[model samples]
Target: MNLLDKFDAVTVEADFRITPEDKAFCEAHQAAYDAAIQSFHELAFFWEDMENTQKELLGSKEDTYLSSRDGPEISQRRINAHLEWLHRAVISNIVYHFNSTYHVSVRDDYVANNLLPQMPDLRIYENKEAREAYHKKLREAKIRYEDVFDQMLLLLDGRSFTEQAFHELAEKCHKAAWNLYQNKANYERKKALISFNGYFCSLHHYSWQDEWTLEDKTQDILRGVAHYETGSFDVYPLGFSELLGYQRSPNNEHEFSTCKKVKGLKMFKNGRVDIRFTSETYAAEFATRYLGLVC
Candidate 1:
């Protein structure tokens, strides 16, 4: 017989003794598989929607000439909306799979590799209170799936994998995603550090304070400026300043400058700071402390 006919003949001649319990088990497995597929379809739809929103936001910038003054504000609103949608997409994926009986490993892998890494700083621009609420939710989700995630991670780490190719692939994908995230984080940190010198120069020109104090209000202002410059809300600007040896005065108040005077331009002019000091004594101090440069 031909291949198709031989397969059919074999099926017809099969004397498989199927019991009622075996049939029930097969049906249950099929049902679970169907549910898993459906969950994936829903995730696909969420991703498509997210991509469309991002595209629309990018397209909105095409009319830059018309809305030159309001362009940034409009772009920011769209960006916030996109971030909110992304947060919802992640939460939806986790919730859907968490409720599923099958493919628990997939859910665990996603949470451990993707969601947990981004927790506490998921790019959501909510207020401190709102961010805390989301953090609580994330913590609960992690607790729920952490055991399964650990089990799967251990299983995927085995040296011999004859039938675990799929698990291996999942591990590789997770690692790649994590690496991409780390690279992005490194890029942001570098950019933020580079911009700090410029921001310090600008601060000298403000006439707001003769000497910068490390107060809560100062920290908040620095945070806002850093956010404006780098589009990063994750890094603490004050922490960067501390790393540069810019400590608060002993009395926790602003004080006059103590560094020895250089021959060139004064760091501050007309009650404002000069930008050129980026290469002067201040820059030397910053490099020595922040960049670990001996000079």
Candidate 2:
């Protein structure tokens, strides 16, 4: 059968696929997909014009900031932003488009089913050397950002929309657009998670684990009881084999959701769980919930 036929087959088989709850989510995804395509066209045109202008200005030098090294620095920043935007938009579009087309769960159903490509760890972009190495790898493979755009167009055209087709195109576009940034890919994967291992150990009245100090600072989240950053820790309450979800206090009826101001919970094997709070208020709240103490 053709690609369109496969889609129709899936849709017919799952007649009860989209629920009433999915209406808003599906519409939101559609809106985002439309906006992302528009942004891609805008960025591509702007980048082309900027690249040409930079090339023309190469021989002209002056003491002014615009004519000095700042000019190139500013240009690089713009290019970097463009690349980052593309990377995010492409991934989002693929996920959203797949869900929208099939009327599937508008969440990360593609991700869970392995239909989308895995994103590179955001930390990889933080290192200049690593970025250059990745750029070289892309060059060796002869990949370009334009190829990613082409794949996007193909996917949008309804020519091939099966899961396998999406997977192939997503992998190609993800790699191409990611490599487009090179040394300038500085997208933050999550909130800033600083190491508080020292503080954690000190608070618990225990000695610090040397291994915790060596955890990669670039990772937005680290999982382990011993970590000082964004990961969760495993906590065993008295007579309980499982760790607490950190959802609520022993007596409270309400559950606390992990958010920007009150982030909590993760576990590394054979290590204690840890928590990171944005402010002293939340920190104290966490203390009261789990530790049975006020901060």
Which candidate has the top score in TM-score? 2
What candidate 1 gets wrong by more than 4 Å, as runs, is: 1-14, 59-295
**How do the residues 203-254 of candidate 2 rate in per-residue lDDT, one tens digit apiece?**
1122542222212221112221122222222322221222222221222111
Worst 10 residues of 2 by lDDT: 197-206
TM-score of each: 0.17, 0.26
In the range 23-47, model 1's lDDT, one tens digit per residue, is 4544454455445445544554565
| Reference-based lDDT, residue 200, model 2 | 20
TM-score of 2: 0.26
Report how far residue 75 has shifted in candidate 1, in Å. 23
Instruction: Flag clash pairs in model 1.
Output: 204-273, 205-273
Q: What would the C-alpha RMSD of candidate 2 be, to one decimal place?
A: 19.3
